[model samples]
Target: MVAVGAMGVAPAAEPNTQVPAGSRHYAASDFPDRIVASPAQDAATGFAVAWRTSTLSAPPLLELALAGDSPDMGRLRQITANSRILQSENGTSQHHRADIDGLQPDTLYAYRVQGQGTWSAWNHFRTAGAAGQPLTLLYFGDTQNKNLSHVSRVIRQGWQTAPDARLALFAGDLVSGGDGMDDSEWGEWFAAGGWLLPGMAVAPAAGNHEYFEEFEDTPQERRVLGGHWPVSFALPGNGAVATANTTYWFDYQGVRVAVLDGTSALDLGTAQAQAQWLDGVLADNQQPWSIVVVHQPLYPLRAERDTSVLATQIRPVLQRHHVDLVLQGHDHTYGRRADDNAALPQYISSVAGPKQYRLSPQARATMEPVAEDTQLFQVLHIDGKQLRYEARTATGRLYDAFQISRDGKGRKQFTELREGRIAPRDCPRPVSPKGRDDRCWE
Candidate 1:
C-alpha cells in the first residue's frame, strides 16, 4: 500500500487487512465488470473501451454497430482487442482494450464486450461532432474511499446534476490503496460507477495512492505507479515516455482536456518532460476552452503542503496558454482559491469520498466557501465563449456557483454569481478513544 501524508491534518489510518465488502463473484459465463470507456484522442472519429474478466487467457472480442431502425444484429462488426493478464489475490483476470475507429462524426453507436462464454449487455455511446458544439462534463476529486459505497452516492448525484455529461474526469486516487495487492478495491470502485462508465468517456490522473511499493533502490516511502493504472484504463498514449497512459490529452467538441500525472512528475523523474509536454499540448490547443486535470493542486489548501514545484513549472504554461479551468484533488477538502490573479486559471480542489480534513486557519481565511466533512462534485458546461461551473454536495445541494465568459473585446470576465449557497461545515474533530473512528460520514 502507498503512504498518504495529510500535510498538517492528521488522517486516521484505515484497516490494512480489511478487504472490500460486497459481491466478488465472477463465473466463466458472466459478463465483465470494471468496464470503462475512453474518448478517442479525436472523439469525433473514434472511442475506446476496456473491461476485465475473471477467466484467464480470455480472447479479446468486441462487437459494435450503428444503432438504427431495423438494425442487423448479424451484421455487427467484431473487433479484436489487445489483452493482458493481471494477477491479484482475488484471482487472475484479463484486461482487454479495443479502440474503434473509422466512425462517423456525431453518430450514436452500440457496442458490447464478450468473455469466454457470455457477452455483456449492449451499451450505446454518442460521438462528438465537428468543432464548435456545447459540452458538459463531470469532475470528481479524490475518491479514495474507506467504503466504496459511500462515494458511490456522490457519483450518482453528479450524474443527476448533469445527465448529458459527455465525459467524467477523476482527479486521481480512485481507490484508497491496494494498487495491485487487492483487486477487490478496483471492483468496488467500478461497482460505484456502475453502468455510467460505459456510456461516458473517463479521463483520470494518477495520484500518490495509485503508486504501490517502493521504486528500485529507493526508500519504501517512495513508490512507482501500479501496474493497473495503465492497463485498466487505456488512455491516450500521447504523453511523456513511461507515463503515456497516465498522462495524456483528448479533445471533445470544442474543449481540450489535458490530464497530467502528478505522482510521476513530482516524485518520479518525469517532471521536466511532463512540463515540456504540457507546454507543447497547450501551445497547440485550438479549442475554445482548455481544461487541465491533475491530482495534486498547484496552490495546495493543506497547511504543511507546498506544491511549489508543480506551481513553478506547470502553472506558467497554463497561464501562458490561457487555460480556462484547473481541476484537481488530493487535499481531501473542498475549497477554491481566492487570490485575484487573473493570469492564472481558476483553481478548484474538492473531495468525493468519506475522508474529511479540518480546514486550516489559513485555508478558511483565504479560500471562499470552503467545506469540510463533506463530499463534493463539480459540473462544468461550456458553450461558445461562456463557461459555467457549479460545485454541489453529495445530496445535490448547491455549495458554490459561478460563470466565466469572454467579452466583445476578447477579455475574460466573471459574471452571474448564483447565491443562496449553504455555508461550509466543519465536522467535529477526532473524538474516538482509539482515535481511528470515522464520524464525518455519520
Candidate 2:
C-alpha cells in the first residue's frame, strides 16, 4: 500500500491496476455535461482552451477549431482535427479534458465537446483583454471537508455577489482526504458548482486534501485521484512543479497571474531545482499588476497558526520577487495581513464554506467577534491605475472595501471606501464564550 501523505508518487508498472484499453464508454449526446477552460496554452499569447467529454469512455476525442461569432457550427471560422484522450478513475464515470490554443487576444471564442453519443452545446469565452486593461477576478477559499451543504452556499452566494468574474480561482483544498480518493466529495463539489462551471474557468491549486481518500474500501479511491486531476481542468503549463499543465503562469490583460502549488513545494523539490527559474519568470514581467496564488496561505488566520517552516523557507523568495498580490486558503477564515519583512506578510484570508472556525488574538483587532464568521468571499476589480477590492458576506452584503492607487509605485497604498457598508462582531472567540462549551456536541 502506498503511503497516503504527499502525492509525489512516481508512476510504475502495477500488476493489479485495472486500466483497460477502453473500459467505460459514454456517448456525449446522452450526457452532455461539464465543459471547463484551463491551463492557458500560450504564456505570451491570448490563446486558452477547455475540455469536455461524455460520462463514458466518457470524454471524447478533443475536436477544436477557431470559433466565429455565430453559434452555427457550419458558419464557424476554423476547425482542427479531432484530438482526444481518456482518463478513467475509481469507476465513477467522468470524461477527461483538453485545452485549445493559438487564439486571438481579446476575442470571444466558442467551443464544444463530444463523447460516445453526446455532444455539448457550444459555449463561449472571451479571451483576456490585452495587458494594462482593467479586469475582474473572483477569489474563493477552502471548500474542504464538506461540500454538499457548505460548498453550495459559497458557490451560490459567489454567483450572487459577482456573476461576471472573468475567472474563479479555488485556492486549493478542492477536496479533503488530502486526495481525490473521496469520490463522493469530489462529485459533491462538482455538483454544487455546476451552475457557473460552463461559463467560468476553475483554476485549482492542489491542496493537501487532494492527496487523501480510501484506497480499497471504496472503488472511487482505487483508480481515481491523480488520473482525474489532469483530465478535469486544462490549466496553463506555466507552473514549474511539473509542466505548464500543472504549475504554470498566465497573463490576464494588465495583470500577470502566477499560480504555484505549495503542496508540491517540499515534495516536488527537484522539479524546480533549476536555479533562477522563478526569478527569470517574474523578472521577465511586463504586466502592471502581478498576483500569485497557491494552496497554503502565506498569512494564516487564527484557526491556523503553524507556518514556521513555510515562512522560513518560502517567505524570502516572495519578498525578493516583490509580488503584488497573493491569494490563498487552508486557514478557513477571512484575514488580511500586510507588512512583509518585519514579521508577517500583508495578506487576507476568508472562509468560503458554512463549516466555520474561531479566530484568535495573535494579531491585534483580529479576535473573534471582532472579525467575521459569515461565509466569506472577495471580488477584485482593476480599473486603470486604481484597483478596488470588496469583501462580502454570504447574503451579498459588503463587509470591507478598499481602493488602492499608484502612489508608492512599488509599495501599495490603500483608500478606504467612504460609503461601503462594513459589518461588525459575528464570529467565535479564542476562549469559549459563556453557556457554550469549549467544544461542540453539548
Candidate 3:
C-alpha cells in the first residue's frame, strides 16, 4: 500500500507495488506515461498531445503521420513539445504538450512520443467528421473505487459495448484516493484505459475531490488540484482563466460538449464568471445537440445535498440554450430526471465503481428508473436530429434506455426505448445507524 497526501505531493517512496505493466510510474523514465490526445481549437482540424517523462529524460517530441490502409506508417511529421516540470511522490518529472492544427477532418492519424532514445507505443486516433455526422460517446461518473480494477472493468465493458466511441467523458471524481495525486492510482487508471487512451480523446470535469490546499500548520501535507489534474491530462484551454484546466468545451460532429468545474465555481467564488461564460457559449452554440458534463448533479440524488446555488447559477443558461443533456457524477447512485418545466436536456447521474450511496425519495420521485449498489455506464448516439441514450451495468446488463428526437419545428419528443426489460435495483434500507450491513433482512 502507498501513502499519499490528501492533496498534492506525498513523501517520496519506493515504486508502488500497484504499478501495472505498460503504465508509467512517477519516477523519472525515458519513456512517457499517461500519453493522451485532447481536443484543441477544433475537433476536426486540431488536437493536442500530452505526456510525462522522468526528470532524467530530456524534453520529448511527437511524431505524427496520416494513417493509411497499408501497415507502413508513411512519412512522419515532427512536432516539438513544450515541457513543464512537475513534482510528485514518485519524484520529479516533465509534462510535455503539443497542439497540432490543420489536420484533415475525419481522417485517421498515428502518433508516438519520444524522450531521449525511448519512444512510446504508436497510438492511432480518428478525427471527428463534418457536422450532422453520426457519433457515439461514453460517459462515466465518480469512478473512484477502493481498488482501481473495479473501475477498470467498467471502463473496458463500456468500450466493449461501443468499441468505436469517439470520446470518453468523465464527470469528475476520477480517483478519490489521495485526491487523485497518488501516482500509483493514476497508473492504475491509465492502465485500466489501456489502448483506449491516446487512441480516443478524454474530457474530464473536476470534482470536489480534485481540489485541495495545504493546511496553514502542515505545509508538507499540501492539498491542491490533486498532484495530477493539471499535468496528467492535457484538456482544452478554452475556459475561464480561473478554472482553466478543468473548464472547457469542444465539438464532435454536431454535438457540443461543455465541461464545467462544479467545485471551483461553488467553492472558489468563480461561479459568476463560469455562469456568464456558460451563458455566452450556450447562447451562441449552433450545434444541433449540446451536452454539459459537470461533477455535482444540479438535482442531487442525496437528500442531505443542496445544489440550489449551482442550479441558480448554471441551470438557467442550460435552459436558455436548450441543451440536450446534462451528465453528472458525485452521488454514488444511478438516476435520470426530466425537468417538468424544461425537457430538452435530460439530467442524469451514475456511478461506475463499487461505492454506493442511498438515493433520496426526492431523487426517486423524479427518475422513472433508478439503481443503487450497481456499477453502470452510459452510451449515447447522435444522428441528425435524433439522440439515443442507454444505461447498462458494468457487466453489460441493460437497465434504462430512451430516445429524444427534434422535429422540424424544434420541438423535442422522447420515447422509452426499453419497456419491460428494465430492471431497477436498489439496496435495502440499513437495519442500524452504523450502515455496515450490506444485506437486507425480512
Candidate 4:
C-alpha cells in the first residue's frame, strides 16, 4: 500500500481472496471495474481512453470506428488510433489505452483494440466541441466501499435513467482501502459497475481512498493506487503531476475540468507547486465552464465554516476565475450552498457511497438541500446559454433540482431555488462484518 498522508487510497490486489466460487480462471478475457472514458490530450480534437483487463498482457493497440448506425457516419472515413501499454501492480499486466485524435467536434466515434492477436468488440465515445455553449455532465459523491453491492446498482441506475449522459465525475473515497490491498474491497469496486463504466464517459477526482501505501524510497508518493488508476481510465495529461502522471486536466466540449489532488495539496509539499500550476492552468484555459474536482470539499458538510481548510486555500482562485462549479466528496451526506461567494457563486457537496455517510443533528436542523446517508448523484443539462442542475438519489428520486442560467460572458442568473431538506438518514453504524453488529449491513 502507498501512503497518501491523510487521504486514503483504493488498493489494487489479486483476486486470490474474493473471486465468486473462487473462479480464478475467469480472469481471462474479463475486464476490471473503474472502466470509463476521458477526454484525450487535444482539447479541440482528441480524447484519451483506457480500461482494465483481467489477465495482464501487452497493452491493446488499435483504431476507432463510430458504433452507431447513423447515415452521416456511413459516408465518413474510419480513423486510425495508437494504443499504449500500462502495467498494474496487482500483477504485471496490460492496461490498454488509445489517444484517439483528429475527431470531428461534437461528433461520436466508436473504437476497438488489436492486441494479443485479438480484436476487441467495438466501443463507443463522443467528442467535445470548442467555444461557448451550455454543457452537461454527471457527478457522483463517493463509491468507495459497497461498490458492486450498492455502487453498481447506483451507477447502472444512473446510466439506465440518463443514457445520454456524456460524462461522469467522482467526488472521491471511491473505495475503502484498508492497511494494504484488501482484495475484497477492490473486487467489489469493479464488480459494482461491471461493464457500465466502459460505455459512459467517466472522469474521476482523487479521493483519499484512491491513494495507496508506497515504500518510503519510492519518490512518486503512493504506488498502490498508481497501479490501479492509469489504465483503469484514460485521462488527458496536462495536470500538475506532469512528470508523475497522476494529476492532469482536460477540456470537454466547452468546459475545462481541472482535477486537483487534495490529498497532496494538503500535506505533500506540492501546495505551492500545484498552486502555481493551477494559477496558470486556470488563466490559460478559457473554456466556458471551469470546473475543479478534488476529494475534500472546500465547503464541508459538518466542519466549522472558518476552519474549512480547502475552501480557504482554493476558493479565492475559484472566485477570481469565476469558476462555474466545484465538485467534491468525503463528508458522506448530500449538501448544497448556492451562491456562497460574497458576490455570487454555486457550491455543492454530496456523497454516493454506502459507508460512513450520515446527517448530523445540526445539519438536519439547518435544512437547505440536505439528505442523510443517501446514495445520490447530480445530473445537469446544458443547452445554448442555459444550465439546469438536478440532485437525485440512487433510487431515481429527484431530491433537489435548480437552474443557473448564463446570458453571455460574465452574465449569471439563478432560478427555482427549492428550499427544505430530505429526511435524515444514516449508514448502519460501522461494525465488524465478521461479528454480528447492527451497524454492519450483513
Candidate 5:
C-alpha cells in the first residue's frame, strides 16, 4: 500500500455499511426526487436540469437565480418545464426538464424544481469557465451491482477528491437492469451519488446495460434506449438522429467530451451513423483537448468479450481526429493501454461496482497496471497544456498516476508517475461466475 502522505492523497474514509432502504423508500412522491443537473451543448453559457415526480396535475416549474450570500426570493426567475409521462414497473410518474440558457460564463447559480405544489430544496452549480482555465473532472466506470451497498462510498470518495470538479462523467451501466423497469436500481444509483449528482454537471454514456430488447419482437437482437434515460437526464440532444440525447457532446472549458452509445451503435446497427456523426463532431471541435466516452471499449479487457465490430467502426474516426483519451466501461475490471503510436488515443477501461471479471490474455500481456476485484474512480485535472490523471481505489489509495502534456505543434508527451503507487491487485485465480476470487479482496 502507498503512504497517504507521500502520494498526497487523503486517508481512506470509513465505508458506508448501512444497507440501502427498500424501493418504496425511494418511490416518487409529491415532492421532487431524482433531480439531476446536466451539461448543455455549450456548457459555458447554459445548462440543463431534470427531475421526477408522482403527479403532473400542474405544470412543472423551475426557479433559478445567481447564488448569493443570502437567498433573495425576488431575484428568482420562474421557468415552466416540459414534462413526459412514463410507465414503469414501479408505477407511473412524470419526468420534467428545463434547459436554462443565457447565463454569464463561469457563474454560480442556485435552482430548485417543483412537484405539483411542492418544491425541492435549493441546489447550486457553476457554469464552465473560459477556455484554457484549469478544469477538474471525476470519472467512474460501471456502478451496476450493489450500488448503494458497495459503490456508494467510492462515489463519495471521488467527490472528496475533486469537490469542485466541473463534471462527473460515467462510462455507464449505471444500474443492473437495463430495461428501466426496475426503478429500484435507478434509486440505488441516485442514492449512491447522493447530493453530488445535482451539485455538478453529469455526463454519462449509455452502456449495454442501459439498453433492452425483446427477443419476441424481432428476429435480430435490436436494443432500445430505456425509458428512464431521457427522463433521468436532460443531456445535450445533439448527436446522431437515431441515438439523439443518448449520444451527445458537450464542451467544458477547453475540453470537448463526445459521449457515444456504443450499445446502440453495435447492436442496433447504428455504427455507421454514429461514426459519421463522430467524425463531424470532432472535425468541428475547437477545444484544445478531445475525449471520447463510451461504454464498450474498442479494446476489450475481459476474456472472450468481442468488441471487433465496435473498434473497427469507431477507432479510425477517433484516430483521424487525434482524440487524446478514450474512457470506457463494461469489462468490470481496470485495464489501461497506451499505444506505442503516440498519435493513437490512450484507452482505459475500468469498473466502480462490486462486480468483477477476468482479464483477457491480450490485456494481461499488453496493458500495464491491470487490476481485478478492486473498485476505482479517476480524477483528472487539466491546466494549460498539461493533463494530470490519477486512478484511486475505493479506499482512496492512489493506484495509478500519469500526465499528458501537449506541445505547440499538438504533439503529446506521456509521463507515468509511479512513485508512491500501490501494487496492482490482480486475482491469482480466475473470477468466479458470481465475481468472486478467494485471493482478491474488495
Candidate 6:
C-alpha cells in the first residue's frame, strides 16, 4: 500500500503487490478515510463532518465528546451517519456524513467515525467563539494539479503558520478533474491535507473544474455539478433554492463568509438568483466583517479570459454591501488590487497549486505586486475593527502584506504593508504549453 504519512507526504515506493499494480493511495479499504470537518450555519453551537469508506453491510456512525484529559468513553455521544453510495471510475464506495450539534461555543471536541468494525483515529476541533471575538483563518487558492506531490507542502506550511486557525477557506478548483469521476484525485487531495483537515472547519467554493461537461461534442453540451461535491461536504444549505449546497453562507466568530458557485452561476443560468440571494445575505449581515469567496474573479488576470458576467452580476452586490474582502481563484497566478473607489471590495486572486499562468498586460497595469510561478497561501486575522492580512510563499516567505481598518461608521481604510516585501516573481515571456517556461523566476 502507498502509505501517506502524518505530514501528508506520500512515500517513494512501488504500489502494493496485493492490489492491482497501478493501485496506489487512492483505493479505499475497509477503514474510513477522507475525513473532513465543516462549520454549521451558526458555527458556535454546531459543525458537520464527512468521510468515505468501502461499501459496508451496515451504516456508519460518528462519536463525539467534549475534549478532556480523561478517555471519557462513557460520555461519548453516538450520531448515526447518513450514507450514500457513489460509483466512480475508481469503483463504488459509500460516503457518510453526520451533522453534529448541541456543541458549546469556544470549546474543543474530539470526534471519530466508525466503519464496519474499525474506527478512525480521534480528531479534535475547536468550535467558533461567540460574537465580538477575534478570528484567525487560512485562505488557499486552487490545489488542482500535483496536489499530492506539490500542493501538499503549501497546505502543510499554511497549517504550520497558523495552527490555531479556526477555518481554512479554499477559493476553488480543488482538483483538476471537474466530474469527480476520477476518485483518485479526491483521494490525493484529502491525503495532501492529512490530519489538518479534521482539526479546522473547511469552506470550499465550487470552481468550473468541479463540474463536468455533459453531452460533449454536441450542441447540447452543458455543465453538471459533480456527484462527489454534495457527498464530500455537508455545507450549510442556506443558498438559493436551486444552488443549495454549492452556494451558501456561514458566520464564524465576528465574520460572515459567503461562498458562491461561480461555475453554476455562469453556466447553469443561476447567476441572477445567486446575486439576489447574496444581496440579502450581505444586506442582513450583523457581523463586524464580511468576506466573499468565489472561483472566478470579477477582474480576470488571465489574458484570454473574461469575467463580464461576474462583473455585471456579482461585483455590484459586493460593492453595494461594502464587503471587506473578496477572495478568488482560477487565474492560477497571484494578483491583488484594491479599487480606487474605497467603497469597492478588495479583490485578490491567488493560486496554491503548481499550475502557473502568464499575467495579462492589463494585469501589470491594474494589479500591483503580481506574481507567477509561485505557490502561496494567505493568513488573515480579524479583530474588532481591523483586519491584518499576509501572503506567504510555499517556503514560508512573506510575499505581500496589507491591513484594512473600519471606522465606527463602517468606512474602510486600506493600508499597504508591502514596503519591504519580497520582490515580485514572474516570467518575462509567456508560459509554455506545459505550464512553465525555463526562464521563469520565482
**Considering summed lDDT, which 10 consecutive residues are worst modelled in model 1?**
20-29
Off by over 4 Å in 5: 1-23, 178-181, 216-221, 428-442
Per-residue lDDT of 390 in model 3: 90
lDDT of 6: 0.86
For each candidate, the alpha-carbon lDDT, in order, equals 0.79, 0.58, 0.79, 0.63, 0.85, 0.86
**Candidate 5 local lDDT, residue 82:** 94
RMSD list, candidates in order: 5.6, 9.9, 6.7, 7.5, 5.4, 5.2
Q: Per-residue lDDT for 410 in model 6?
A: 74
Off by over 4 Å in 6: 1-21, 178-181, 428-442
What is the TM-score (0 to 1) of candidate 5?
0.91
Q: Give candidate 6's error at residue 334 in angstroms.
A: 0.6
Clashing pairs in 1: none
Candidate order by lDDT, highest to lowest?
Answer: 6, 5, 3, 1, 4, 2
lDDT of 2 by residue, 297-396 (tens): 6656654466554555655655776665677776666666554553123466666764455555563364222244567677888855767877777777
Q: Give candidate 4 misplaced runs (Cα > 4 Å).
A: 1-35, 41-44, 54-59, 68-90, 130-134, 179-188, 214-225, 242-244, 302-308, 360-367, 419-442
- Candidate 5 minimal-lDDT segment of 10 residues: 12-21
lDDT of 3 by residue, 1-442 (tens): 5556789554331222355545445465777778878876479887888888876344567989998778788898898888888776667778888888889999999999987678898888889998778899899888765435577888889999999798889888876655334666666677777777788878888888776665736746443566578877777788877888788888888888889989887767777789888887777787788899999999999768877788889988888888889999989888988865966679999988666777888989888778887889999988778898999898888898899998877678888777644567878556322345532211
Residue 215 in candidate 6, Cα distance off native in Å: 0.7
Query: Model 3 misses residue 187 by how many Å?
Result: 1.3
What TM-score does prediction 2 earn?
A: 0.76
Query: Which of candidates 1 and 5 is the stronger one according to TM-score?
Result: 5
lDDT (Cα) of model 2: 0.58
Please give the ranking of all candidate structures by TM-score, highest first, separated by commas.
Answer: 6, 5, 1, 3, 4, 2
The sequence of per-residue lDDT tens digits that candidate 5 reaches over residues 1-442 is: 6447766964332222232434355568888989889999899999999899997788888999898887575578888999998877678888999999999889999999999788999999999998789999999998887788889999989988888787999999998774333587787788888998888999999887777776746677566677788789999999999888689998999999999988887788888899999999999888889989999998888777888877789988988888989999999889898755663488999899877777778889988889987899999999669998899999899998889998988778888899989988876545453355532333
TM-score of model 1 relative to the true fold?
0.89
